[model samples]
Target: MTAPDLEQRADHIVEQIDRFVADGKRVVLSSSFQTQSLPLLHLVSRSRGVTVYFLDTGYHFPETLEFRDQVTEQLGLDVVSLHSATTKAAQVGPHGHLLFAEDPDYCCYLNKTAPMETVAAASDIWISGVRRDQSETRRQLDEFVVRSDGTTRYHPMLDWTEPMIADYQERHDLPRHPLDDRGYVSIGCAPCTRNIPGSDRGGRWFGMEKTECGLHVDLVR
Candidate 1:
């Protein structure tokens, strides 16, 4: 889509978010604080008391945590950091060490998906910064979708391309994720993430066939 087309789509999503809030629906925006996240965060923060959920997998890069703090403070966001039930020590004690290396899927299930499931139960709607151009798996996603549990997900930037995102961020003067300059296009946990140029998700789960970290997969399934 053209830049203007993407802008219009973003406006529509903000309108939908406003409508949902006005109608008294509980809504939460899930963000990874990646390169594309700030625009969505800025859009939702326009409405008061909208919770922005960030998954704290404990394995995240220090730069990601710092970026999260910066954006939350800069936007005055109503942010909630979700974490796994098991502590890093507890997880490693029983499961051996580096669960992500041994079983990335299950590691993600325990760290990311489980916490989000709790958030999903408490909220009527979930908003995310997922874009179609990011990956082949994401290309099938719709602008609006209803999950099996009845929570509606809104992908405001589903049609947005990298240029569109860059345009929006530059227009708003949004801060880029620190890792972005270091070639980390898609930042996840530190162990599984790498620096891969020219591919949005090539940096994620580098050599594995794993595309998603179970959160999106479990939600859509």
Candidate 2:
């Protein structure tokens, strides 16, 4: 689809969100403070009724945490910092050894899936920034979907492309993620993500046949 078509769909989704709030719905934006993720955060922050939540995975790059604080204060966001239920004793040291190599999915569950599930328990509408052009897995996603886990999901930017995102960021004078210019178009936990050159590998967890961090995939099934 063209950029205009994508923008129209995004506007439509935002309008629906506005209406949902007017009708007393509990709306939340599950943001990661990614460069592209900021636009939706800004959108939700404009309304007092829409809440924003993010997981503070212990493994996040220091820069991500800094940016999260900066954006939250700048936008006057009532952001909830979701934490992993597993204690430091269970996650670290020699005994557990989760996500050292083949157990990336397990690690994702603790850091991404679980924390989000906890925060979303009380929310009816959960907004996401997933876009179609980001990956083949994302291409199959619709603008609005109901997950198996029960939270209503909205992907306002589902059909948007990288160029479209760049334009929007530039127009709004938005800050880019620190890693965006360093060959990493998608950013997640520092260890699970890497730099990809050219127009390839748009998804995080690339080169491993894993397109998601267990958050989206767990919901699909």
Candidate 3:
């Protein structure tokens, strides 16, 4: 009943099911299980069409892994986990620590974007719970568009404000991220993330100029 008649707050995703889902749609809800995405996942579970995809970057917070299972169990969502075709020694050093300190872009390419590319080739439309309020890059994203890999990106939550997402999640009794109260609205890799007072991770990648994870790194390409 969230979008029975379909309204502006709906972001037009359910209305465009044709593009998001085919005979065997292969539609994936690319989620970090971030709070902004909770509403989208809730919508997908009730729809009975799309499958949720979670990229196991190997560096996610421990709580994130736990919440991932909890949501899957609670939502009754059939989740597909994607992982990089690399090993720990390949991503990190021989010491088994991440190499993000030396090369953040390559790190992301291997961890987040690389695995997603493999699994998402199952369909043209990859629905993400991306919101413009989350980052500067997202602010310019369209509701629907093609990516550099010839895959169409669907951002159902593009126009949603943070408060709107929060309100809807609460109304629906959706599960908030276990760490949301800790000021990690835009949670990411464990090492790269930290808490900021009254912040939704505007401080993420703070010391660096990087805000995105190379998911759309082709803006310059």
Q: Which candidate is the best by TM-score?
A: 1
Candidate numbers, best TM-score first, in rank order: 1, 3, 2
Clashes of each: 0, 0, 0
For residues 23-115, what per-residue lDDT tens digits would candidate 2 score against the true structure?
887888888898878777766766678778788877778888888888988889888888889874576534556563556777778777888
Q: Which ten contiguous residues of candidate 3 have the minimum total lDDT?
A: 1-10
Error of 3 at 163 (Å): 1.3
The lDDT leader among the candidates is 1
Worst 10 residues of 2 by lDDT: 93-102
- TM-score versus the correct structure, for each prediction: 0.93, 0.86, 0.87
Candidate 1: worst-modelled 10 consecutive residues by lDDT: 89-98
User: lDDT tens digits, residues 48-154, model 3?
Assistant: 67778888888888899999999999999988778888876777754556778767778888888888878667576688877778667777778777766677777
lDDT of 1 by residue, 114-221 (tens): 999899878898888788888877888887889878998877878777887888888889999988887777888999988887788887999999989876664342
Query: Scored by Cα lDDT, where does model 1 land?
Result: 0.84
Residue pairs in candidate 1 whose N, alpha carbon or C atoms collide under 3 angstroms: none
* Quality of model 3 by C-alpha lDDT: 0.75
